[model samples]
Target: MAEQVTLYTNPMSRGRIVRWMLEEIGQPYKTEWLAYGPQMKSADFTAINPLGKVPAIRHGATVVTETPAILAYLADAFPQAGLAPAPADRGNYYRWLFFTSGPVESAVISQACGFTVPDDRRPMVGFVDMQRMMDIIASAITANPYVAGDAFSAADIYIASHLSFSTRVGSVGSRPVFADYIARMTDRDAFRRASAIDDEARAAQASKG
Candidate 1:
């Protein structure tokens, strides 16, 4: 029998990324929507995640937390969905995927918060400046149709969401490549559906006040 999958998430958090991944994989999983504030820090939720973060999942007896782990696990578990690169492409697949989640995210957050490493220690930070990170990401898309090469794998889901979020937060400049990439990802049926649901959830929450 297939395992029962339960997703614990709050729409306002990084859970949105998990939501997008779920939609991309076309899976039927249960969602336990969590309210923010004290509820997230409750003992029950803390048992699932000691850090009290959103976007945790339970697949049968297996409990997975962290956004990147969830993405990678979903792709591997649902091979028919074609969410991952083939074994031969695993090197590059893992490379860019971690790059986006780690360095790219770190650099963008730093820049958005107006924090900077010591001028002499910049090279040790593992990411070029934000503009350079944006340029490298943009150039990657321009050079290849998707983040992990030609195939539209889960890497694109991660990368696309990062680009979209960065653009919205003004961390990424409005370069042509960035704009086009956002348009491409947003046009996807799965993304549209996920976005509509998110919008509806937000609107409904606002209506209660």
Candidate 2:
């Protein structure tokens, strides 16, 4: 029997990505929606996540937070889902997974906020800056069809998600590789279903506001 998965999330948050991942896993799970502000700050939600963040999941007694961590956990927890690469081919998997969740995300957010990290402080930042991160990513994707390799894996789901969001927000430039990668990811049925769920949730939340 499958374990019960209860996902605590917000429609407008990174929870969208986790929802998509859940769809790919093809498992039944429950979603608890939280409106940002007081709802997210509420003790009910904060008890599950000390930071009071969404995108946290409880698989039976196991509690996992952070989008990337949740995705990684799902891959291992549901081995039958086939979201992970074979043990021998996991190097690229870990590579792009952490890079996207860490450096690439930082660079995009920093640029979005109109902040720049000087060269002297580059060592402190994993990606250094937006341009450098783009250059590195362009080269990586150009070399491989997917983040992990030829076949789609959890890494592709994660990195492509960041690229998709960055594209929508005008943070990532109009590189053909980025566009093509996002196009492939967004076209999946899992992506469509997960996004539709969030869209409805977002609309309902807005109506109450």
Candidate 3:
């Protein structure tokens, strides 16, 4: 039986990444937009995700949270999408995908807040510092066309979303590699369609007030 996928999200939240991924994968999904504050904390929605976060997915009877996990799950479930890397390429695939969610995101958030790991724990940190993480990511793209090598997979969606979000939030400076990556990802028809729909929805809500 084909799985039924439903996404609960808000456009302004991290859920946007999942939204883009859904569009890229061309899966049919039902979206429930939750407003902030009391609406998101409502009992009905809270049951699905105790954390009251957006981007939760109901696939059949299973509920999945966390952006990276959702991305990985969708890719595997829909093999026809060609988003998952083959078992042979699992090493690079998992490395870049998890790196974006783990170190790269952590480093960006920490740097934005002007925080750093204690000197003694620096080596234990996945990303010693934002600059180092940025340098490594930039070098990877310059060295290889894609995050997990030549093939574009779900890893690209995750990495591209992070790079795009980082650049937009000023966490990442305007570098050529960042600029190039964003340009390429945004140029995709799927991305453009999702972005346009989100923009329209936001505009409609604004005009109602």
Candidate 4:
């Protein structure tokens, strides 16, 4: 029998990304929703994630955290879903996936928090400028139908999610390329399903508050 897969998440957190990926994989899994604050920082949840962050998953004995890592793990674990490209065709896959997870997100979040890298220190930073980062992203996405290749992959999920949030929060400029890519990547049943689940959960939380 396949080991049960369980997700520890809050609907309002980055767990939404994992939810979308799970929907894409079409797997039967359990979701353990934890409210923010004490619930997340409690002893039990901390055992699963010392950092007490949402979007962590346990596939039997295997525990995975971080949105990008979770997406990558799910894609590899369920190869039949085809969320990962062929190993030979994975150059762009690994590239954009890590890029978005690391430099892109770091830059976006840093800027959003009103922290800017000094111009002289740009050389030391992993990402130089927001416009430059956006341009690079635009070029990569335009080069292929998807970030990894002609077919959709886990990279798209992470990249699209990042861009969607960043653009919405004014961290990244709105561009036709980004808008089109996000629409194309998310114009699927999985994305819609994930959105609906999170939306409902978020609404319920608001009602309770």
TM-score winner among the candidates? 4
Candidate 1 residue-wise lDDT, 1-209, digit = tens: 17867889876778788788888878788888888889988999999999888889989888899888888998888888898999998876788788888889899888878997999998788788887787778777777777778888777788888888777877788777878877886677888777777778878877877
* lDDT-better candidate, 1 vs 3: 3
Tens digit per residue, CA lDDT, model 4, 165-202: 88888889999999999999999999999999999989
Which of candidates 1 and 2 is the stronger one according to TM-score?
Answer: 2
The residue-by-residue lDDT of candidate 2 on 149-169, one tens digit each, is: 887777778888888888888
Off by over 4 Å in 4: none
lDDT of 4 at 142: 96
TM-score of each prediction: 0.93, 0.94, 0.93, 0.97
RMSD of 2: 1.4
What does candidate 3's lDDT look like per residue over 1-209, in tens digits? 28778989887777777877888889788888888788898999999999888889998998999999998988888888887778788787788889888989888888888886789988888775677788888877666777777777778888888888888878888788888987876678878878877777777767877
Off by over 4 Å in 3: none
Q: Which candidate is the best by lDDT?
A: 4
Q: Count clashing residue pairs in model 2.
A: 0
TM-score, structure 4 vs. true = 0.97
Candidates sorted on lDDT, descending? 4, 2, 3, 1
Q: lDDT (CA) for every model shown?
A: 0.82, 0.86, 0.82, 0.92
